[model samples]
Target: MTAFIFNNLNDMQANINRNKLFVASCLSLLVTSLSFGIRAGILGTLGTQFNLSASELASIAATAFWGFPLAVVIGGMVVDAIGMKKLLVIAFLFHLAGIVLTIFAGGFWTLFLSTLLIGIANGTVEAACNPLVATLYPDNKTTKLNHFHLWFPGGIFIGTLIVFLFEKMGIGWQIQVAIMLIPTVIYGYLFSKLDFPVTERVASGVSTAEMYKSVGTPLFVFMFICMFGTAITELFTGQWVGVLLNNVTDNAILILTITTGVMVVGRGLAEPIVHRFSPQGVLLISAILAAIGIYMMSTVTGSMLYFAALIFGIGVCYFWPTMLGFVAENIPKSGALGLNLMGGAGMFAVSIYTLFMGGFYDRLIAEKLPEGASMEAYRTAAAGTTEAAKYAEAQLTAGPDVLKATAIIPVILTVAFAGLVFYMRNKKKPQLAGA
Candidate 1:
């Protein structure tokens, strides 16, 4: 009778600890999304204040992407060795320092380095939390991962609102940057008190050699390539909303807010959708919608932009988490390293594509100007009264063109995911037939 009571107490305590760990993971991811939201809000401000070109602004933004892949790949490799708790501790320290450095940043390099630190922190969050969630809910990996990742878009929704309201109140960007510290501190505190579990691979007794071998499978390779497209389709567009849609909308950042808002809702209700269609089917459908939405966004204007953004939000809402979930389900042997590598690959692709988009935007702007007009001359004229309208018109043209080109990425993904869906269905058919 005493042993039974003790066992029940132990079970209760374990459940309580699991809940705390999950909550802490969510808060840590919240910091990452908040940073994304706030950075999107401040991109234009940074450009203007620092007298930066589009490419330079992109370089600054792309630094985070570079740092993200670096940290996630390394953290993924070592997570089993050093554990999730230590990775998160590193995240907390980097986040704290990054926020402070960004707040006091005077120029481009400071901004670049600070954002890199924050990016490392963001990657570390995924490195720890994704595997942690997969381990915690082994039977329900896809559904639970979607639930865990909902906080990403949810946090962005909250962060955008914070930026919007604070901007209305005439607050500076530094304050907006600093506000991220609240959730950071909370997650840090929570993690400090909680005990972490071993990664799913460890708990399941998958050998390290087997884990490495599994990631090289043909399907895993295909998925790794697909991650590049899906990530750029979602993240590149989300991050560039300020610049891409600035001329078309009065408050372009609201487009990000609205998009993320839809994402939060979609991810919140993902269980039913994922179960009904299966992850592969959902990926195919999401790819189709994302293609159409990006194309529509390029062509649409005014209030119609909101509707296009809604379609896009729904399209990308399931993308990141579902991709990770698919691997966790299909490539269980690949384990935490596979999950981290998938994420890292996506960010690495985005970093390269971000630079391309920035350069593309600038090139388009240059082409739209008078035959011999220099960007420097145009900037000088626009600052005064004479060419401001012309500059605006050029942005109006260039921005949509950029979106039009980006639309091609999702179109390719649609074809790829359709193939994936078909392959997965057929792959299951033989077993069913034999059974």
Candidate 2:
């Protein structure tokens, strides 16, 4: 789809309720991100409470990631045709169901299903709002998308505070998950009356076949693979923060707060950075910084971990939004399908790595344990006893092992993004055949 240039108001005026749309869109992503934060905080709780192994727990987390790609890719395909309103409503219903099911979760399978539902809802919100935001502020796609995405880390900051507060008060984790509903409901209500502009794809009258044609190219396929590494590197590490540090320090949530807080601030300041580095240049540097940050985080304890988390947070801050923004800017013909697929690939890839990292920890933890240590006995052992204590020791070592393994993803990404930067710069911007 050729971008609809709003050279004359009579041609295509974008004078909708932008402030309300922005607020609703931020809040939409807020609930999605809030689930991530709350999930991170409760990971250890779920692990011990349900006697789940590292792999089992990660499988449950994987369910959350697994549901995202389907919803995002499918919703992206029809978001323009069906209107943003229906997708937002679907998201609201799924969020409500997912939250309730999670609170009443009986065990691993129940939690998995609940989280899967919530992930679908989260994907739907992204599918709808990303295109909506781009349409609303066409002239400032990167900056506006960054601001819209700031709520992701902003919501993490809020959820982390709630987790810390609730833990201090002896409140149940269910209440923490439920607390996300406040913003969920607010966004749902705000969107009820809001009018969403058609996506640029629809406005420019791009056919579905044309959208496929653009997205099916080798360049788009390569980007799909690159986004996978980018998402897993940012997401799985963030998701595992609480579990990784729980055995190392009582201050796990504090570390989460620090990292997410840095992300929020970094995104708020992204406007000037986008001006300085351009999105592709910034992404190349981000991959480099993320690789160093994860490697430095191998300590998993000590005061320096906080500093490392800050570096990691700033490194990943621009990745998600700018990746999408690049498509909006450079691959305009791919339309909403390309945007959603990029995100879908990222989320889908993270789900796979969540499971992969879990299995890695399981293997590493086993190697460190006594030769005859029975896994089931360790699971059932009383909190202060020998097997239980050995398990605790295993967890501490596992945290760093997983981080060390995960650090390689960003190293690969550093190389891949460098190639992307080269591609973005040296090549003339390609025009759509019909444009």
lDDT of 1 by residue, 272-361 (tens): 999999999999999999888888889998889989999999999999999999999888888899999999999999999999999999
In terms of TM-score, the best-performing candidate is: 2
Clashing pairs in 2: 1-333
Local distance difference test values of all predictions, in order = 0.89, 0.85
Top of the candidates by lDDT: 1
> How much is the lDDT of residue 434 in candidate 2?
29
Q: What is the TM-score of each predicted model, taking all chains together?
A: 0.94, 0.95
Q: After superposing candidate 2, which stretches have Cα over 4 Å from the reference?
A: 1-15, 430-435
Query: In model 2, what lDDT does residue 294 have?
Result: 87
lDDT by residue (tens digit), candidate 2, 1-435:
233343433144456788998999999899999999898888888887887888899999998898989899999988878988899999999998999999999899999999999999999998899988887776678888889998888888888889889999999999999898899899999999887777777666567888889898888888788899889988888888888767777787787788889889888998899989988888899999999888888874688888888888888888898888878777877988888999899999999888988888888777777997787687668988988899789878888878888899889988888888888777666543323
- For the record, the alpha-carbon RMSD of candidate 2 to the native fold, in angstroms, is 2.3
* Model 1 segments more than 4 A misplaced: 1-16, 380-384, 428-435
